[model samples]
Every structure is written in structure tokens, then in C-alpha cells.
Target: MTEVFFYHLQKQSLEAVLPGLLEKAIERGWRVVVEAGSRERLEALDAHLWTYREDSFLPHGTAGDAQAALQPILLTTAPDNPYGAAVRFLVDGAPFASAEGYERLVVIFDGNDRDALAAARDAWKRAKAAGHDSTYWQQSERGRWERKA
Candidate 1:
């Protein structure tokens, strides 16, 4: 069974929640791969992980073609692209070829707007609908981190 883990980061920076998630993934002996549009952003969280490759750019267009060739199972980020932000890759299945290689899917959002929440909800629904077990971890209005319960 594919276990879906969702983590909602309510704080202003990814710092608040990313470390904990990376730690848990590491504890489980999972290899971590992070992709983001900004090098500075990925660096803020990369310090905690043991092994990570940084791509200051995102997966799109011709660049996206190269990323697909690489075939990374675990994609992590505070996505800046609208498509990435919407978690569209999970649905498209093109840029992200297969789900079989990944053990889990984790998305951490800043939760600044209702649309982001809606996107997260929709992504989870689609993943579940496709029978690819998924979950979301996000921050509540009160400013504490929690998973979808």
C-alpha cells in the first residue's frame, strides 16, 4: 500500500516544518530529493538532510524534459510555478512519469490563501480518486502544524 503523508507548514518560513519531515523521512531510511525554483529557498532546509541535490530551476518546458529523463521519484519544494503550486504534476503523469517508484508524496504549503488550501484538497482528492493513497500536512489558523486527520 502507498502511504500518503501530508505536512502543513503554517509558519512564515519553510524552516518551521521542513526539518521535522526530513527527519522523519530520514529515520525511515528514505532518500530525500528536493527541487525548487530558488537556490536560497532550498538551502534554508537542505542543511538538515544528509544527501540532497539542488536545482535552482524548476521542471518545465525543455528543462522539464530533462527532469523527466532523470526520473526522480521524490519531488520536494515550496513550489513557485503555478502548475507546481497546484500540484498538477501529480495529476498529469507526464513530467512525473510513474508513481510506482515513490514510497510516499509529501507537499508543504505556506497556506496563505484559500486557493492554496483548495489546491491541496483537490490534489489529495485526485490522488485518492486515482487509488494512489495520499495525505496533506498543513498549518491550522491557530498557527500550529498538523496533518490531515
Candidate 2:
């Protein structure tokens, strides 16, 4: 079963935290797929990942990129996994219908958004009911991620 994790973004914006998480996944030698709700959001993220910080950037490509199969991190709006990713990230209210072939499924939602919170809760419930091991994580005041449930 795929392990599901909910990351409740409160103290930090997704831009502030996502690169680090992607780095960690890459460190683990995991291929990743990040799915967004819109093409504009996906395009923005594709650009951001290349220059998320002045010092370093996560190597990634969108589905339309050449040799997408070789990208360690892929960003796409498509419902299916294209890069044979081991981990999948659903952000910006992207719908997660299942986690069939992935090792991990991470759902990141902004705590300040009521709709995002509702959707995360629903995803949690569905994940639990499907027998997927699920955990909830929230950012601490100092901006470190802490597992809350």
C-alpha cells in the first residue's frame, strides 16, 4: 500500500517549502511527479523549480519536455504518471483519485484556505478508508515540519 501524507502549510508558503521536500525525495533516489490543478500553476512551478533559490534548484521537467522519461522530478496536470515516479505530490487542489503504483502519495494544502483544508480532510478520510497508511504533518512556528497525526 502507498503511504499517504498530508502536509498542512501554515507557517510557510508552498514556494518556501516545496523545494526542500523535492530535494529530500531526490536524495532518496526517488522519481517524483507533482500534479497541479491548472496548467498555469504547473507552468509556474516548472519555472520556479529551475530557480527556486539563488544557490540551487531542483532538476525537473514538465510533461511536454523532451526526454521526460529521464527527468527525476516531473510536473504535470495529467492524471497518469509519466515518469514512472515512485512518489506523487498533489498540490493546488489537485484531485487524487488513487495511489495505485506509487510508493508515497503526498497532499499539500494551505491551512489558510478553507476549501483546501476541506479537501485535505476528505483526502485523508478516503486514504484511511482505502487502507493506505496515512500521516498528517504541520509546520511548526520555526518552519520545521512536524508530524501532528
Highest-TM-score candidate: 2
Model 2 accuracy (lDDT, Cα): 0.92
- lDDT tens readout by residue for model 1, 1-149: 45555455456455544545555555565554544435454444334232333532222222243453342223434332322221222211112222344566555554665754566666567667668877665566776766665
- Compared with the true structure, what per-residue lDDT tens digits does model 2 show for residues 1-149? 99999999999988887898899999999999999989999988888998888899888888888977788999999889866899999999899789889999999999999999999999999999999999999998998889998
Q: TM-score for model 1?
A: 0.54
Cα lDDT, model 2, residue 19: 90
Candidate 1: give the clashing pairs: 6-136, 6-137, 7-137, 8-137, 8-138
Give the poorly placed runs of model 2, Cα more than 4 Å off. none
lDDT at 108, model 1: 52
